[model samples]
Target chain A: MLKLLTFVKNCKEGVLRATPKKPRETRRKKILQTALEILPQRGFDGITLESIADALGYTKPAIYYYFKNKDDLVCSLVTDYLKDAHQAICAITDGNGSPKERLIRIIHFYVDRNCEQRGYFTIDHHLGGVLRKMPHTAEADNLRKLSLEIPSRLIKLINEGIQLGEFRDEDPAVLGSLIFSLLGGVLTHMEMPSLASLGVEGLKQRVCDFALKGIVV
Target chain B: MLKLLTFVKNCKEGVLRATPKKPRETRRKKILQTALEILPQRGFDGITLESIADALGYTKPAIYYYFKNKDDLVCSLVTDYLKDAHQAICAITDGNGSPKERLIRIIHFYVDRNCEQRGYFTIDHHLGGVLRKMPHTAEADNLRKLSLEIPSRLIKLINEGIQLGEFRDEDPAVLGSLIFSLLGGVLTHMEMPSLASLGVEGLKQRVCDFALKGIVV
Candidate 1:
């Protein structure tokens, strides 16, 4: 009976310890979610921790406890986003069919992701300029490295495609870079008054077709 | 003798009137040139009238005499660039062999201009985001309209290409946008370490080839 009592007491203590962490995690996610929504419209300079806190109806200190500052919050947001994007890309590139097929899948993946989380990309592109001007931090360095890796990995895939005769024998480096530029341009101008009729899926199909034709034999 | 004296007097007055205006025009050009040099490196936020004056060894008041403020200065620079670019594009589109030939010429023109004046393009791109958050000014609105016209003109050309059956019967809007994205992607990543070996001419050739292949029958 004493042993049973001790076990019950330990179980209650364990739940008490675990419950606080869940809300903290939940709160951190909520902060990131709110920031993502505001970021595309306001940009990096326009957003403030106070603004984000106000949007969430939380106190400044509540946000501070979760994020060190605005940069920290943005870095966290980008890092989380890059981590997931990198993983998805790797899974696609590593677990793929022919190089051309993988490349097509990547185009679909990139367009779909941009369509869904355009704010992240707008902020990401803006961050490219912002990070260049600011003093380098470890976090900024990691973000830069992560951003470069995506392109380099795609370039590698393009190189593989060229070697296997799946793609035309063009400079993969140039081809890869051009493909990225094309996708970015589409994203940049996706909201043109004329393009509204295509919707997301239609836009994706056109982008994939255009991008593939440039590279295919 | 009286007629000769009168002619000399008129000549003297003409020189006196032209002298100060010449220097004033030259000084304004100098200010715009210096800002162009600094803007791509520092972006819109990092530049100021004082910093520009410092670079030019002129007083801040001297810059003020020429520009009302930073936005005014940037607007002037962009306006000058757009006017020239629009005229050049119009010339090419108007005096071309075929739509495909005209499109190829445009790709070359764009790539060459970007290579020569990379800073202007970079700052112009950064301004797209900056203009969005700030209160709308007439100057900003004009800049936005001018920027939109470049692509719209190209889209019109693509539509012409489709109608003439020189290019594939794809959505002209989609094709034009994708072509722009491809060229822009080239500009964005033109400085990548891997792409360094391909000189400007080589890069332009590759870009034109890739772009034309996508839309040409």
Candidate 2:
């Protein structure tokens, strides 16, 4: 009876701790989502801090509390996106097989997962423009560095496959670019309104199939 | 005296014919060159025909003399660029080779030629937004269709490769997308001022090296 009472009290305390944190997370996520959709249309050069806050019906002070400045807000949005994307890229070759098998798995993972995280790509679209035109603070550089790491992992795996003689001997760097081009092409068409109506899954599958043809022996 | 008179008459006629035509062609070429540079930075919505004419100290009417409208000017500028790009693409295939060799040649031609055509890419930047927001006019539709053809050719090559037992069988459409994405990843990086300083040739070489590893047998 004494232990049961302690367990009940602990469970109630846990709920109290989780409830406040959940809404804060929810609010931050909501801000990121809205920012992604709006900024791409107006462009980062054209967007203002007040505009973002007003669009969300939040006070300037509230946003100021989350992000010290507009740049901070933009960097945080992209950094969060890259971390998620980086994970998905690593997930591509997690299965076991010949190097060829591993690469095929990676291609599907890249396509299907990118299909799910389509929103993440807009962050990349704006990333170069922002970094090039805007000043490079630590946050901007960090975001840029983290973003490139996504492809670096895929390169690492292909390098490994080459060492194992699974892939044909060639410049690993060039192969990575060819594959990267393939991904860009697929994404471009997928995003087009003319092409988007074909359905995301169908397009994703086609992209995966294309990626495999180029890499598989 | 008669021979001297005849020589002067012939010279006068030749000078009259050459003078007007040469300046007209020179002015038209000058306008096109300035438009390519300015259009990329200001965007189609941001720039005006007046601005283009002013850049060269030509009258707005002079620009009109060469071009019927903004649409006509844009189309005329792109027509030559598209013709060159199409020729470069055609040069990629060897008529007969292993699937891998043919694909590699195609990849090589693209990277080499695309590097040279960075100026042309700038013109296409604002087009995505224009196409999305505007109705499907013939000019817009034509550009859109032309854009898709590059990848379609790549897809066809992949299909041929599979049929020849030179490549692992895979969907041609998907292969087209992957190569394009790989190209985009490289091209996007080149737009960065800091990285643009790295020179497109270097970037293309590295990106192509990395991409080939993932795709080549």
For candidate 2 chain A, the 10 contiguous residues with the lowest summed lDDT are A208-217
Complex DockQ, candidate 1? 0.56
lDDT of each: 0.80, 0.65
Compute the lDDT of residue B130 as modeled in candidate 1.
57
Q: lDDT tens string, model 1, B1-217?
A: 9988977886776654446568878989999989988887777778899999999998999899989998788778877887788888888888958888889899889878888877767765665675564458887777777777777788889889899988899878778877877777678778876555688888878888888888998
Q: How well does each candidate superpose onto the true structure, as a TM-score?
A: 0.86, 0.64
> Which tens-of-lDDT digit does each residue in A1-217 have in candidate 1?
9988987987876654447568878989999999988888777878999999999999999899889998788778778888887888888888859888888888888778878877767665665666575458887788788877877789889999999888889778778877877887777878875555688888777777888888988
Off by over 4 Å in 1: A1-18, A127-145, B1-18, B126-148
Error of 2 at B110 (Å): 4.8
For lDDT, the strongest prediction is 1
Residue A43's lDDT in candidate 2: 66
Quote the lDDT for A148 in model 2. Answer: 71
